[model samples]
Target chain A: MLWACLRFPQLAFDALRGTLPNTPGAFAVVAGPAQRRGIVFANAAARGAGVRAGQAIATAQALCPHLCLLARDPAAEQQALGAFATLAWRYSSDIHLREPDAVLLEVGASLKLFDGWPALERRLRDEIARSGFACRIAAAPTACAAQVLTFAHDGIALTTTAVLQGALAQLPLAQGGLESATVTALHGMGLRTLGDLFRLPRAELARRTGPAALLHLDRLRGHLAEACPRWQPPARFARRLEFESAAHSTTALAFPLQRLLRELELFLLARDGGVQHFVLVLGHERGASTRVAVGLLAPQRDAAHLLELARVRLERIALPAPVYSLALQVDELPPLTPPHRDLFDTRAQGGLDWPALAERLRARLGDGALHGLACVADHRPTHAWRHTPLDPAAPATRDATAPAPTANRPFWLLPQPLVLRTAPQRILAGPERIESGWWDAHDQRRDYYVVELRGGQRAWAFTEAGSRQHWTLHGWFA
Target chain B: MFTSTADLFALDSLPASTAWPVAAPATTPASAPASVPAARNTAALDTVLRHPGIWRRRAPGTSALATQPSGHAALDALLPGGGWPRGALCELLVEHDGLGECSLLLPTLAALTQARRRVVLVAPPYVPYAPALAAAGVDLRHVVQIDAAHTDTHWTAEQCLRSGCCGAVLDWLPRSDYRELRRLQLAAESSGTLGFVFRPLAAADQASPCALRLRITTAMNGTQFELLKCRGRLGGATSLRLRA
Candidate 1:
């Protein structure tokens, strides 16, 4: 199941460049030699104003007085890439994240589920439309060609190694993130195209271009195999969306759905969260509606997964008599901490990483995941207790199993009170004394005692000395 | 001698449901009365939010002046509760024609004019005791009455509650709608004024929002009042059988 990949030459940069085109401006993102805070990226706008890579700060600034300078924020780029990775992860878990900006995922596993090759293309087109930039996808039998093609301006340019080699023949050597010195050396030797370099004999090329460039060349021409690692969902966080009205038109339903799905990034970012299951509900005009839900092999809450499951399922389903509302409910929250089956695995942002877990579940499952149990004291077993929605803004639970103290707990606590057969329970214990309500007749003083023995099971009992011969059992541990 | 441990028993966990505990007589078990206060009428759903305010406060600039517009006035002057204390609660009892309920409320309203305070009426569904109130000398011209049909109870109650300048607030509503009046009663208390509530026939002398709860019925010449509840100091709910 080969899915197509279409690339839009340099649209992201183009968009950035277009922001101030024709007005002497330059842009570049400088990665600090090796640190995240380093100057790693700058726009073409900043560049036009005369800023250059590797130049000292004073020189870069002097060259372009009006340059819009910014320090590299790896976290921001990582988040952006991370969000896209989750989105792409939905198409296929087999994903390779080329940090700072790009990623590649194997969509073969999802092609059929998403309606096969051509439909997948149209679906991607329909989905990514107005998504800010054009993304090119290319699927082939090999990862080498696929990876290279994923970077091509058009879908077919990188489809075959022969065409890739042919195209590479005229391509400049520096385009592959190569050093300028290497490019100069290659250019001086008349080694321009990748194919031209390849024609120079392996040993010579390795000696001249070095292992980095050779490996790049080999990977580009489909001569080697490299795998893209799969992405993991956030650990915790709940995400749910409420629609203003029941969605009657399937085509128009993406509005609210998209906004809700967008929380996937924010929730996951808050804590290392991820989702494993998702529950989508198409709320009806009244209260009753349809539920279309599914679970994934791995946990994930990225918008891509939600959209894939929803889009595919919805395409086949007939909108239920014009839905008046729709809601996506997610649950089964987890924590950002790695499987801590062991005692140690330092975790952070704060302790007990349930927020990330909740975010993940919220992302994948909708907002319904991650519930906290609240006990309600009632004699009726059916009304004994329930799960209350936990507040995200509150502190995360270190251990959900432990009880959290609330304001004033009930004094006369009952896990479950007994159903009296007659006279409410004979006093086995008693006359212990509870006295109040002096001014009103409604007040009385009683002594509670314990009693036992028709068959020897003890029970709590209270007797009213000031009133009728009332003797009643109030509790029983057994 | 029963041992202290004798009265001890293990309790199974359960959910807690609460109710105003005043309905049960001291000698009687509260099994049925416990269910009386949770009245939320789902049948006439429209009246859910339109519920009138069961509570009120004294308008500004009136030194020691309060009003209780009982749909009647002459009856307002003779009452000892003194035309309903401001930021306080007055509970009414109704049978057919509310059993002279209109006549009993007159003096309560008349006493307010002892200073000329404006009265605010909310979502009143029944007819007023016009001639009776006029006879009692209540200044009907100083009244601002709003009538709504089957409204959302909370919204209506909230509107009247936030309107602090109204001298008094009155509403005729069923008790089962909610234990809501207590909340409004608390609001009136905080604002320092009076609230006269004509409750439905469910609770005769139950715990409610008012500092004092009265059960009034109409007699031949006037009305009869039984003090079902009193929360003020030196005051306590006594079944004071009174005829005015």
Candidate 2:
């Protein structure tokens, strides 16, 4: 099986840098127990000023007086690595996450789908870089070999087992992924490179360094099987971002919100689905968390569009307190159906579609502000029509089976019939009786007539049965 | 060079410039024919007439404006383009409600909805009776109603008109100024959608930026329409015998 491994050499620095709004200044990640704290990774600005990794924090500060030191966060690093794996999940399903630094994917089946290795490699590199991560990639015949090759060199591709074996032999014993104690013991035996150890007899090597070292060598050489648990994306997406400091205004939260949205986008891509509804919980410094729920008419995964919708919704909310952290949770992700496009679609390019426009209007207005009209196929004028949710996919045609009204109907109907105190100037037409809803409790027996008001406005006036004096203005012919 | 002042007025002595029609021929080279300059002038005039802002009357039975028929023969004859102008805002100033105001637009709205184009009603005063609309041949599924506040009525209509997905946006604005009408007009023009705004008759005297404005009142036999402002024609009035 062909395997591709991506190693993040500066994962600690990269993970922390993504959280900050800007990283133009000199920065370094210092980790280790309190007394031996040293620079694990230094950014370009610090490196330009002679700051190097593994140097004590004091020495690094001396080299660059203004170095901004951040303690290494292992949780954030693992989260960053999982995000990268989620991105690579689009390329292959058989993915294994190596602790601390690397991830391996069996890309044998994906090579054909991606038009071979070089194309896939270029795509992986471009996407990873766009996601704000620096990675060293290598490929070999086995997963373990591929992981080991990443330390030796970046962009190494060994297709066959013989070639992989030959390449692995040239690497120093330190890059063999062995424990430091075992490597020290092997070094004491005059073994400079992996090829020197390979020349020794198997029984003798196992007697000297124990069976674990032999198993490691055998796994790297494709002799023993390496079983790593496959990483599965969670059923639901829930990502949280803790602010370096409490954000007072909503504007201060836009950057972290955007980063979380980007991660949500990658997560949706991995699942090959779209989100119709998601909630953004703003963790405040005091009181309960504020929840901003964004609902769309259709499933959507575009980050920019989602961001715009979220921003519009956020503007209407009043922050109860300064937000200390933010969380994005999407419980239900429906399958996305790509819109159908004709060869010559007359729609304006880059203009919002119907669903997007409706969402934008509803984002500003309340949810119940917009509705569609549907004929209810009833005899009562009030019960003849109902408001429905606007669905663009439904055909814009009425049911042909419903019987048409014989009498003339007014264009506008009042929500409640208004009582007309005075009589009309003239009657245009006689009463067309309507006695409907007998089976239901709303029994009505009314005689409707077309009447002309004093100022020459037409009205739909109706009177109860056996009473012609009590005329009620039910509708307007506007 | 030492000639009298009268020599400057002479046709032959006048400097050869396009501004002076008589001097243009003298500036022409001997190799070119006389028809070239005349053709160039006609081409320049054609360019000016091609602009949308420039209104020019065309020959009878050869109209150049894009319009949707109002479905009434007499009313269509009174309009400049033989019907309602497309891609522009039209204002209907009603003397009062139920003066055949909704009937005036039922035909055009029906035609648009039948073609599967969306028609949005923003802040309508009353419920648009579905039975009447269905009998009028309007597709019910294509009709969307938006209930917005007084402040957001114009904004919602402008957005629908500019969305390009809508074929018509009908709005009822109880109160609005010239700036709001101007914004709606621009949005309709950009998206090439029909926009109809209904205002009270009192606003008829106020200057509006809509492409067309009509004042509807009741006549002896039927409804009367006075064309207060049409983009390319003089004001005229017509009466139609429409059913209530």
- i-RMS values of the candidates, in order? 27.2, 1.6
DockQ of all predictions against the true structure, Cα-based: 0.01, 0.51
Question: Per-residue alpha-carbon lDDT of model 2 for B92-159, expressed as tens digits?
Answer: 99998899898889899999988878899999999988888888888877889999999899889989
Q: Give lDDT tens digits, candidate 2, residues A1-478.
A: 8999999998999888866768489999999999899999999999999999999999999989999999999998988888888888999999999988998999999999999999999999999888778899999989988999998899989999999888888999999888889999989988988888888999999899899888989998899988878998777899888888888888888888898898888789899999989999999866469999998888889998898889888888889898999999999989987766658767765456688899889888878888988777777778888898876566535567655744478999999999999988888986878889999988889888899998889999999976788899999988
Residue range A117-197, candidate 1, lDDT tens digits:
667666665654545555666665445445454544344423344665666666556654466788899899877655577
Candidate 2 residue A219 C-alpha distance from true site, Å: 3.4
Q: What's the TM-score of each model vs. the native?
A: 0.37, 0.83
- How high is the lDDT of residue A215 in model 1? 80
| Top lDDT prediction, candidate number | 2
- Alpha-carbon interface RMSD of model 1? 27.2
Give Cα-based local distance difference scores for all models. Answer: 0.50, 0.84
lDDT of 1 at A382: 23
Cα TM-score of candidate 2: 0.83
Residue pairs with colliding backbones in model 2 are A478-B102
Which of the numbered candidates is closest to the native, going by highest DockQ? 2
